[model samples]
Target: MILAAGRGMRMRPLTDTTPKPLLQLRGKPLMQWSLEALARGGFDRLVINTAWLGEQIGERFADWPQQHPGADLRFSHEGQDFGYALETAGGISRALPLLGEVFWVLAGDVYAPDFLFSRESVERFVASDRLAHLWLVPNPPHNPRGDFGITADGLALNQAEQKYTYSTIGLYHRALFEQPWCDVVPGNPQGTAVPLAPLLRKAMDAGLVSAELYTGPWTDVGTPERLAELQVD
Candidate 1:
């Protein structure tokens, strides 16, 4: 599941018309590169959740490559920051049905290679039964607020350290969202805003979450300068 719908207020002018995922890095659309990587990772079917500028994104994949032929492609349009975007956890919660039991989720704006394997990685973490398994990168200088969890070979945290940070990318199991949920609807009326961080903290305290520090290049392209840096890399 690609988390593609965001206001990208940080990206202002560039994102005025184009959604952040559609913004190009190097020469291709940010998501196109991601799609190519997913293809390499052996992901055929994809469910993208979109809110802002969703039409153009849908159009780009209309003629999407044949590399992953017979690939089932579906788009869940969440065009409403006021009408459909369910924040982070809220968005996933609403789309859980479409995502199936355990699913891989990534932010559409990030461009990384070999992020997912050529085939599905071992289904190690249980979403319905256990805490989600997150792929975390070392806390970058920009985001000093590091989120971390140390467990006995599990994604569940043991030590209650508030210093380490969490990564935005993860493979989620769907049950930690059962209680203490957030607002899910417009105006957040009957809404759910279950952000991943606090949830991780809760699960960590229970020794239900696990983490792996990614030693690869993962950039949070929230700013134009970072986006520009990504473009040249």
Candidate 2:
């Protein structure tokens, strides 16, 4: 699932009209880069959660099935159901029906141009006992402190001396968002706003999460300047 619901407060004026994922980057809609990459990676279905000018996102990619023959698109329209975009966990909860027991998640606005969504990686994650597997990236200037710490055993820890940013790309098992950690109530259709980090931290404490450092060209296009730099490249 591509998380395209953020208000994109950081992207400001540019996002004032367009959803950040729909914003053009290097002559293509940013989310399309992920869609194309997923197709190349052997994925066939997609569930995109959208808000903040999300209609455009739907309209723009309405023809994805035609564009990529075998691939299909399904949207979890958060704006219509909840009147706004639910944060990460909420959005995922709302879309759980579309996404089965295990699924892939990626932030729509991030520009990981060379990052390949590996089928082998997904297969490995599914086979493992871990509830979630995240990809971490080196801290960017905008978020210098980073989010989580990676342990020697490849498990994600709540905190550590050397931290890395959550790449917003991961494989998740639906159970993590259900009952014990938080009452996401994925069995229902309604959603509540909730950030994903706390839930991830809760699971990490129990050693249910794993992670890997992605040493690739990753850009968080949080501002117009970063978007422009990417365009220049």
Candidate 3:
């Protein structure tokens, strides 16, 4: 699942006319990079959640499936369904029917051209008892405090001396969005907005979440300056 429903409040004037995911990085839209990467990685079925100026997203990729051959590209229109962007967990819950028992998710607004979505990684995560496996990166200047810490055995930590930023790339099991782990109903019938961090933190406390360091070319691309930096690079 590709999360592209953010309002991109920080990316003002640019996002005023264009959704952040559609903003150009070099010559291609930022979300296109992720889409291409996923297709290359053998992930043929993709669900993109869209909200702000979502019509443009649908129109932009209308012929994507034809272009990609076997690839199945579908959209979860949160704006149309709920009238707003449901936060991470809410969006995922709403799209649960389209996802499999286990799925890969990444933020559309990030830039990680070199990242590989390997089948081997998926196999490993599927074989584990963990509910979620996140890829953590070194803290960028904008987020020095980082998001979560990793133990020597690979379990994620809620609080630790050393922490890393969550790259927003992860493998998640359906169980995380059901039962005691989460209260949001499948499809989020009420459209209650929810973030993923709290659920991750809870799972971390139960030793149900794992993570690994991702030392790769990555940028959150949350600001114009960051996008500009990528262009300069």
Candidate 4:
């Protein structure tokens, strides 16, 4: 599932007209890079949840299924009913039926042209007892503080001096978003607004989350300047 529903508040004026995911990096929509990676990684089906300017996203990528070999695109339309995005957890809950027992989640706005969505990685995650497996990257200039900490044993922790930014790409087991651990109601058929971080933190406390440090070509693409830099490079 690709989380493309964000309003891109940091992206401002540029995003006013174009959804962040639709913003181009080197003449291609940012989300398209993720699509190609998924395709190369052997993923055939994908669910993209959208809200602001979502119709445009649907229209643009509607043909991805036919364009990318073995790829099938499905949209979890949050705007049709909610008129706004159901935050990450909410959106995933709403799309659970499509996601099944476990799924890969990626942020649509990030620019990780070299990130490979490997089948072996998925198989490893699926075989683990962990509820979530996150890829953490070295802190970029914009977010120097970073997000989560990883232990020697590869467990994700909330507090640690040495932390890494979450790549926003992860393997998630459905149990992390279901009852007992999660209380956020699903957002499809109906809609709800819920953040994803708190849910992850809760799971972390239970030692249900695992993580790995990823040193790769990646950019958050959170601002117009960063987009411009990518375009220039």
Candidate 5:
């Protein structure tokens, strides 16, 4: 699932007219990079959660299936249903029906050109007992504090002296949305907004989350300046 529902407040007027994921990076739409990567990794179906100019996303990718033979693209319109973007977890929970038992998720607005959505990684995560496997990146300038830490055994730490930023790329199990880890009703009928950190932290405490440091080119294209940097690169 590609998470594309954010309002992109940081991007301001640029996002006022276009959803952040649809914003241009290099020569194509930002989210298209992830789509092409997933397709190259042998993933045939994709689910994108959208809000904040969601219709344009659908129209823009309407022919993606034809462009990539065997690829299936679908969207969950949070804005149309609830009038705003449901925060990360809420958006994921609402789209749970389409995601199935295990899936890969990444933010559509991030620039990670070197990241590969490998099938081996998926198989390894699926074989593990973990509920989620996140890719952690070195702290970027914008997020110097980082988000979480990893132990020798690779379990994600809720608190640690050395922390890393979540790359927003992960393999998740459907069980994470069930009782104990989360309480959001299936399909998020109430359209309740929920962030994913709380759930990840709770799971981290239980040793149900694992992570690996990803040292690759990555940028959270949340602002015009950051987007410009990528364009220049």
Candidate 6:
């Protein structure tokens, strides 16, 4: 599922009018770039998860199947941000049904990048018993502390001190979210913190995880300047 519903506080005026995924770069919306990559990768069925200004973003594809005939594109509109925006895992929890057993999970903020990233990278995970397949990128300055550490064997490491930077884009299975999906305590304002790295690492340590690292062109456009910079490419 394409994650498109973030409230991009860092994206300022651009997000003021359009959702971050809809922000233009290289002559197309960011999510459009991701969609195109998915299409190129032979995936036609797509489910996008959205929240803030959900209607406007959903309206962009009011007749998506017609615009991109033969493609099965659908949207899941998350309700208003009454208190705090749903955390990453929370968003995934809410849309678990739409995603099914195995599907792609991607960040909307990143510009048009190689979605396939390296089918080999994902193949290892897909072949394993892991609940999720993660794409780990080299550490960048923005996330100096990183999130998940990786060994040469591609096993994920847990640490109290150091962590590896993980690209949010990934492939996930239903088992990982079963607990969150069924056990959510209604009216609990403090949402569950479902971090992608820790969960994947646990699966790895237990031999139920799968992962790979890619040195390809990947960008996490969390800031306005990075968003603006991608436009020139």
Write one digit per residue (lDDT tens) for candidate 5, span 49-101: 99999999999999999988888888999999999988999999999989889
Off by over 4 Å in 4: 186-189
Colliding residue pairs in candidate 3: none
TM-score, structure 5 vs. true: 0.98
lDDT of 4 by residue, 1-233 (tens): 99999899999998898889999888889999998888878887899999999998999999887777677789988887689988888899888888868889999998888888898988889998998999999999978999999999999998889999999999999998877767755434557677889989998998999999989899999988898888878
- Checking candidate 4 for backbone clashes, the offending pairs are none
* Weakest ten-residue segment in model 6 by summed lDDT: 180-189
Tell me the TM-score of each prediction against the true structure: 0.84, 0.97, 0.99, 0.96, 0.98, 0.84
* Alpha carbon deviation, residue 95, candidate 1 (Å): 1.0
- Model 2 weakest 10-residue run by lDDT: 182-191
* Runs of candidate 5 exceeding 4 Å displacement: none
Pairwise TM-score winner, candidates 5 and 6: 5
User: Considering every candidate listed, which one attains the maximal lDDT?
Assistant: 3
As for model 1, its CA RMSD to the true structure in angstroms is 3.4
- TM-score winner between candidates 1 and 2: 2
**lDDT for each residue of candidate 3 in 140-178, tens digit (9 for 90 to 100):** 999999999999999999999999999999999999999
Model 1: what TM-score?
0.84
lDDT of 1 by residue, 95-152 (tens): 7667666677788887666576433343545423555777777677887766665554
Q: How much lDDT does each candidate structure score?
A: 0.69, 0.89, 0.95, 0.88, 0.93, 0.70
TM-score, candidate number 2 = 0.97
Q: 102 in model 4: Cα distance from truth in Å?
A: 1.2
Please give, for residues 29-138, the per-residue lDDT of candidate 6 as tens digits: 77788888877776778888677787777888777778777898777666443333455666676666566677788887775376574456456656777677777787
- C-alpha-based local distance difference test score of model 1: 0.69
